[model samples]
Target: MTMEDKREPKRRNPAKTQARILDAAFELFSSQGYARTGMREVAERADVATSLVVRYFGTKAALFEQALVRAIYERGFFVRSKPNFGERMAALVVGDEEARIPAMMVLAIADLESREIAQKITRDVVLKSLADWLGPPDAQNRALHMLTLMNGFTIQTRHLRTGDVPPESVRWLARSLQAIVDEENAPVN
Candidate 1:
């Protein structure tokens, strides 16, 4: 066959390509971090041309921000369903190591590198959404407490390597959080 006949067919769907790029970008940005990761690397990971990445995202910083946001929501940080929600959350926090560590690291970078207003706005919106999911009677407070616990767990275990805290400890933490939920739902005399 001639060289012209050997060329591969082009991708027909822009949306699918964009989604793939975003997913690849999120994974790389999370694992390698924003500062360390490059546009070429992101494009390479996405299996697209570097020009396509720039055409879609404009710049590496913009790509990082968008990727980080997608990663946050994709993790379902505020979309917990009831009836064993706590257990489900525990499974995500403990089981999803690939997503967890990178999220924490990228969040740290966002805090340090991005604007304060962006972080504050994201924090407020996420807390409100989570609180709403959690229900009333100091839902905001409960949500914040739960977030604090999760983020701290991420920082301590993944970053600090704080003593080999076993899987059972994580289970206990989930149970303790569930106790809070149960107490809140209990009827008063």
Candidate 2:
């Protein structure tokens, strides 16, 4: 076959390329934190041109925000019944590696700009949405407490390498979380 006949056109799918870049950005940002991760590195990981990563995400802060949202909220942790909320959240804190990534990313990010983005998203979107889902009777305050507990548990379990949390511990945590979710125990204000 002639050289012209043998040549094949390059394939370009913006959606797939964007997704690959986002996944790479998520992995790197979660593992290395914001200041350490770079566009070139992300492009290398995603197997795309660095310019392409820039084109798709515009800025590192924007990329980080999107990656955080995709990693955290898209998991649908907030979509649950009140009765099983504690158990489900406890399980996530105990074993879900995916659930831990966003928390890790938030904790790891040292850059002020990136930290602000994380804080804004966590507060405006995640916290607000979770509080709304929880319903009233001090829902906002309870949601804050619940998130505090979960984030701490995730970081502690992940860093401590304390393998296999005891069933009793998990149960206690679940009950504690349930107390926050249930309006019966809310302090008289």
- Scored by TM-score, the top model is 2
Per-prediction tally of clashes: 0, 0
- RMSD for each model, in Å, please? 3.3, 2.7
lDDT tens digits by residue: candidate 1, 66-89: 766666676676565576766766
- Which one wins on lDDT? 2
Each candidate: what lDDT?
A: 0.69, 0.80
Error of 1 at 126 (Å): 2.3
Residue 178, candidate 2: C-alpha displacement in angstroms: 2.3
Instruction: Give the distance in Å from residue 88's predicted Cα in candidate 2 to where it truly belongs.
Output: 1.7
In lDDT terms, how accurate is model 2? 0.80
- Quantify how close model 1 is to the true structure by its C-alpha RMSD in Å: 3.3
- Residue range with the least summed lDDT across 10 consecutive positions in model 1: 98-107
